[model samples]
Target: MNLDDDPPPTDAAAALRLIEDQQSATARRLNPDARLLYWPWGVAWLVGFGLFFLRFTPGERALVDLPNWLPLTVLFVLLAVAGAIQAVASKRAYGQVSGDSARRGRWYGYAWALGSVGVYAGLGRISEHLPHDLAALLWSATAVGFTGALEMAGGAIWLDRDLFRLGVWISVINLIGAIAGPGWHALVVAVAGGGGILVVGALARRRQRQRQQP
Candidate 1:
């Protein structure tokens, strides 16, 4: 309507708009809370798998290679998978400092432990009736060695302090199981491995809640 009218805004107005744009971008960028979206879902699936195997019907049991041992097999698989997911999620957890070595700190290291269960089941079938001590020794040695490799590699990869500690712990567990046999190995993992994870998880949760509050 008027060539004489000043073009939409002055240089000062344009500069002000540019500053606001930059601020808006920074505010909207990804933040740690973004993780909350997927975390619950992952946890739900993790628990669901646990309950599923626990409640396996006889019919379902017949399907697996080791149907009678379905509960144990399923349990280990679930544990290993959870470990893998943790590893992956930890890596995906961006814009935050990572405390673990890349793959070593993850539950996938648990995949080896799970596979060892499969080995136990296979061994059970081969013998008319395999002894528990023998099976436990086999599983323990394999689990510890595999877990150690994972931890060692992870320690090397991320130079994680925890990985080295974890490897030491796993190796000790393995050694004890091999030396003492099954009965004691079960006690060690149940009391030490499982219990330790629970304590760690609880502490981490408490810390996380505290951070979110402020």
Candidate 2:
């Protein structure tokens, strides 16, 4: 019989092997190292925003009197550094992999970028009519919500439970902050947004190290 006309394999041994192969492939595609690549980015965000909030605290007056542009500049610099770290880490982790998982990761980055623009623009427009403190609080809360949504979407797309849990934590924290009102806005962002990112980053690093152990 011609090779093209051969029947599908029906042997029990062959079926078992096929199943094992599929499972192996799936495991490889969801490489755990890929998740670890976000650790640095998370840490950077935590540190950057944590410092930003310190200025507002009574005892921490270092950045309080600095030109507003200085904080913005520092934030941009930190973001650039974090982006570089992520790029390098991702290349090391997923450079050899090609297929749906890789494609999804690339698209997820795009989604986050687009979502950030939308959040900034929307918040800016809405802040116009609100009082200064209220506007600031709303902006912070909405930004947190946007970040949570991105993390949740990314986790679902990549099949990462850790990221999904982090997303939920962020959303819940933001909601609580919102309910507490503008008075505690800065504290909420510092504790919830910065602290949450730090915790997640540390957890990711720990998991990565554990997986690498012999």
Candidate 3:
């Protein structure tokens, strides 16, 4: 009896059961819990932009009296943490999988990278010439707008209505925030944009649980 040799074939029914079991296991591993996917960004946006609001209020004096650079630095740090979490989660969900879905995910990731470069690079020169408040508004608005648009794109690719609606909501609020100007923009995004993402994450968790139930 050579251990390396193929085992005897199972009947069709047994083979089917085996396939089903494998699929179930794969699904269990690959389930993209939206909470995990969304919560970190929610927290990042909430805290980061909240800080921004405090440090850069429209009045002559800043509410928190923070150094000019602190809020932006903190925001960037939190965003980096959130991005890392999302990357890890995505890898766990899709690393072993391959096909059209995987290909789409890869392309989408590239889009994020490339789009971010384009936005920042396009703004870099102009930002240096703008006034402080205007620069803040410009940077925040463009970043938020790009993010919302990408979210909509992701929703379309995945055919998820909830995600699509969330993207629309984000874009709308981002526009309102920009219209409101610098300090107010941060406040709106901190409350509405971050808050909305958190709410959607909760709802997605609920839906995922319902689908997993017996």
Candidate 4:
């Protein structure tokens, strides 16, 4: 009955507990209900892009009576605010999964998404003060930068690389097109740059769903 001679049994028990914890974590990852929550947002993007893109003109400035860029700026700031809220809520919801180490901090994208909102908001203000085209150029850069950060986690999960690369490309093209200002070049940017992000976003979303499947 000497406990000092029972080291092997103690080690085996500890190993069993570790295995159980891993299994529990894996089960949570594959939850189907969580996967289902991702689809409606994708659908909304498809609709928004399809309706507005073909006819979108720069400086349309969706905000009502807030000056040209003011409206757009407001929209972005609101988005940033919304993102900040979501980021906080998600930490409460998903707990540690909201941090990195889980698919490179996919939840952190929520924060980055909000950050894009700020960039556009700044651009909106600048556009109001400066020459129309210059304001647009700045806005475009801000928009792309925010978009890239949001996509970083998404790309890691979906593309297996940094999503920021796509962001850089998008920001660069948007910057050029903003400077180019109007006509076919702008059209090309709208269709290509925006569309590319939408497409890749859709695919990344899909990968997220599949990962959660049973």
Candidate 5:
């Protein structure tokens, strides 16, 4: 229980191992699991937008008989849940780590908050002027586009290839869906955008496990 009572590392190898152990602990504390960062959004997109596709298929008649407000409600609820999860994960990972990285993270978080407000403000005004289907497409495209842009920015900040690639993929699908129009957009994003993120999250977790192994 006394600091002076314990023996130190007996050899160079022991000392190196001690250092490695400390570095690993610090890394873990500094980097939250990628699954936590990604999977929540993946599920949100997958289920939320999947429902959107069913409910708002391009034709006036919906493929599935869902309440008019159900898809939007579910999507917003899931997005809020994802945001909460990411916020908690970020706080736990970076709460103690200070420096430029912490500053950048805080700024990035601010960007997300402010960018969302701006997007909603602009969309709210313009969406009212558009037809229902076009309005829906505009909302989905812009939301996805905003997310992809932020993902790319985060990747650039962290120098994370996986994150950047995921962002690129999201952005591409968003564009394609926008071009394709409403029903198809939701289907594409729900399948490709959401599914791709899930795959990336799984791969990231696998890499983390491999790195942690002896």
Candidate 6:
């Protein structure tokens, strides 16, 4: 019996074992730290946006009526923190993955950063012709919706199904918000955009934990 010349395993048990091994290898190649960072960042964005939207609603006047700069300040602070976490996670992922994957992730980050700046600038330029409130609503929806598109692109690049699904869900939510118009923009953004991010984050966390388990 020559082992080198033997046919590959084709029985049900053998096939199952092979599949499991492949999955294990894929899991091992993924960045655990990156997976862990996602849900918390999502939660932070949810809280930040929730507070920002409070100003327009009657129920949370305390949050809404604070100095105009306060909410913006808090939101930016949270974003900075999230950025730091992402940087750390990226470093950890870089250590584990190939150079090409790390470089891809870096370029993806750059694209998002540039895209955000472009969205803001473009919105500001065109806002002059529209009513103030309508312009603001359009700005918010477009900016946030662009983020979703980037997520979808990243998911496709990485072959991450969950992230891809999250991107689609986010785009749908933003579309609904747009259709709802300026009157419901704040509420839609808070409930749909923020909440969608939170849900996606939680799903990512759960999937990561399951993959880590024996």
Model 6: residue 63 alpha-carbon error in angstroms: 8.4
Candidate 5 local lDDT, 99-207, one digit each (tens): 9998998898899899999999999999999998889888989999998999899889989888898999999999998888878999999999999999999988887
* Model 4 per-residue lDDT tens digits across residues 99-160: 34554555555565476576667667668888754554455445544565555545556464
- Please list the Cα RMSD from the true structure of every candidate, rounded to 1 decimal place: 10.7, 6.3, 3.9, 7.9, 2.6, 5.3
lDDT (tens digit, per residue) of candidate 3 on 78-127:
89998888888889888888999999988999999999999999999899
**lDDT (Cα, tens digit) per residue for candidate 6, span 1-214:** 5479777677889988888887876665566544455755565557666666675443424444666565557767887888788777667656756678778887998999898888889888999899855875787788768978988998999998878887888788788878877636656666776677677777877777678554
Clashing pairs in 4: none
Please tell me which model should have the higher lDDT, number 1 or number 6. 6
Where does candidate 1 stray beyond 4 Å? 1-71, 80-84, 87-132, 199-214
lDDT of 6 at 8: 69
Clashing pairs in 5: none
Model 4: residues with Cα > 4 Å off, grouped in runs: 1-74, 77-89, 96-129, 149-165, 182-190
Ordered by TM-score, highest first, the candidates read 5, 3, 6, 2, 4, 1
lDDT of each: 0.50, 0.69, 0.88, 0.50, 0.90, 0.72
**213: Cα error in model 4, Å:** 3.7
Estimated TM-score for each candidate: 0.46, 0.69, 0.88, 0.46, 0.92, 0.75
Q: Give the worst 10-residue stretch by lDDT in candidate 6.
A: 55-64
In angstroms, give how far residue 33 of model 5 lies from its true place. Answer: 1.4
Candidate 2 local distance difference test against the native: 0.69
Candidate 3 deviates by what RMSD? Answer: 3.9
Q: Which candidate comes out best when scored by lDDT?
A: 5
> Could you tell me the lDDT of residue 185 within candidate 2?
51
